[model samples]
Target: METTQNTFEQFKLNRQLLNAIEEAGYTTPTPIQEQAIPLALAGQDILGIAQTGTGKTAAYALPLLMRIKYAQGQHARALIMAPTRELAMQISEAIIQLSKYTDIRTVVLFGGVGPKSQIEAIRDGVDIIVATPGRFMDLYFREEVTVKHLNVMILDEADKMMDMGFMPQIRKLLEIIPVKRQNMLFSATFSEKVERLSHEFLEFPTRIEVTPQATTAEMVSQTLYELPNFHTKMNLLSHLLRDEEVFNRVLIFTRSREVAGLVHQYLLGRVVREDALRVIHANKGQNTRTNAMEAFREGSVRVMVATDVVSRGIDITEVSHVINFDVPLMYEDYVHRIGRTGRANHVGQAITFMTFADEYHIRKIEKMIRMEIPRTKLPAEIEMMETPRNEMQDMLREIDNQKRKEDPTFLGAFHEKKAYRPPSKFNQKDSRARRGASSRTKKR
Candidate 1:
């Protein structure tokens, strides 16, 4: 394929911004940026839906910076709303990198730390504000910042914001901002709720989806290992990380910060170097989180463990492998987790640890993704894990019991909390309940 990159001068962007883009080593525009930038520059309301790691930040940021540079006033004209504190900071960093030579000022607002510094930054009169919903609302309500002069608004990762339950905050923000302004909603996927929210914010929007819905990147090679349970997963992971190539730049995604720390400690015991592994999650303070992310990006940390909250906005390109320490709650999350790697035509691997309980979820993921993920056998040392097997089966039974509990007509087959619920007794309500009643009457 021919390279479509031209001198930044061709875009008619401010000379300073162009210099910064060149300095940042962004020679070519990714597909999303190439398609969306022109429309956004023309002052169009854009709804851009593409998988993560497609360079969507520049797709909107470059044009917004250009527009802001060309226009008159300089009072917080642009606002970018991200879902998490980490993401908000990441977007702010991108803006700074892209606007290095320009005189544009930016501020990031998030709740984990104190608000004094953020308030001072806003008071200093910035041209752009990148913020999470909670802290932004707090400052907005306090009248520390005003959107009355806002020119452009961008919602990066709109679906994630919705998934994190920020709809009410987003709606309030929309109502607060002036009616006549440019708006853009960029996300990995557009669910029904995202569409509904967009209708309230955007006027005559141009919708664009770069990738198919519910599909993962084609460049990612996915594999699943049916571990007996958590401990055996740890054993397998220890073995895999021992391979120097795989240990370098590995990212492990867990469900929560507590889990991330636990995994990090467990891995630390087996790994030779203490500095090889780092953990980042929401519970950590801002400085700790920033240091961890920086270490991961600069190649100082070999294996970085994180929760989903920190995963979306992380833009590291050379991540070697993504390990799913815990299966995600939603099938779409599997796609997102693996998306951390194999970005922008670079081949990468995604290894998932599945227990018996996770088997059904894995199957559902396959059905949704429409392809069978290759299964990998555990190493011999980890194979003799009968204890984890029992735990795995017990976990599966627990999940099955929960599903059966949800069935409306499921009658009590046993008494007390000690009762055992078998899969055979768990059946659909209409026919089976009547059959059971008739059988009981015959016995009577």
Candidate 2:
């Protein structure tokens, strides 16, 4: 018996897509692609469960492009919804690349910038509309987008959309679009919310899971550093980035925009060059974020610091290390953040900095991923900075809050004093005054 080779050509894609795939340097299909493309091509709705950086975009985009074939009418025939503007743009770029040899035009809609240009793109001619839910609905209400011609609808990062509360808009969209269209839903992790969304979005869909849900990439090595405070994490980050060979192309993730900015500022001109470090968050301008992302992708930026805004869909294959400057409270996002590295079967490192308060979240993340991250001791040469008094108090308060959340009856340290108090001299005097007032009232 002879076995056939697994290749994109085996899918019977058109010559144009085959050419584009070859030019794009794709040798073979990824697991998700191998499993999903055929079902999608057969006009079956797909529920794809795959982690980030697993060629999920291609798995869906290729089939969508093949179905669209060529641009025909002035309206879009397909709609792709993403949770964030960054992810919307990323998917649009991938679709454009895959459909280069064809005449299928795609227009990306997002809210950070004005809709003037996007409206113009739609007016000119578009076969596909890739957009965030809010922006898509905005354009739809304005009569700029018509769903009558839509034959396909896809929800990329459905779990993220559920997290960001896009369900109402999604439900509204479902009502407006043609009910006869094929549907596809892709999620990095399958949660209860995602499962419910899948039931609502897809009709008797064929489910494909390339990997066990929420599992990290096998090529990435994960390590944890239990530091005392944020300052010590900064110290460890600085020390790690000093070694250029190993830390060459790095992505640092923080939980908030403020932390992302601080990480960028700390590394500027100290560990990374001023021009080689870029930061992005929800607060950054659209142009600034796009330029920073482009620069990082083009290899001009050595280190990019970002919040979870860019975690789910932005695909950068050469990331050498992903430094979790702060543990993510949303445990699923931990999988997406580490996935920024170890892309395309490349060996990568994921280093997490966990403070005392972060330990609770880290445990939750480990439980979700079904493995404990290896802990490493700080190098002897790097001095562990003493945590400031205020920061220590904040961490303690956070820990107390976490504990209280887990056990509602368990009062926090600050609440313990209020819960039980011995009778004081002031309390005794107040009690005597109350008793005298009660006796006076009784005499009256």
RMSD of candidates 1 onward, in order: 9.3, 11.7
- lDDT, candidate 1, 190-285, per-residue tens: 778888988887899998888777688788899888765566677788888889776578899998877788888887857636887788877788
- CA-lDDT, candidates in order: 0.80, 0.89
Collision pairs in model 1: none
Put down candidate 2 lDDT per residue, 330-419, tens digits, no spaces: 899989998988987799999998876787898889888999999997775554555567776787688788988999887787765644
Which candidate comes out best when scored by TM-score? 2
lDDT of model number 2: 0.89
Worst 10 residues of 1 by lDDT: 421-430
Let me know the TM-score candidate 2 reaches against the reference structure.
0.91
Instruction: Say which candidate scores most in lDDT.
Output: 2
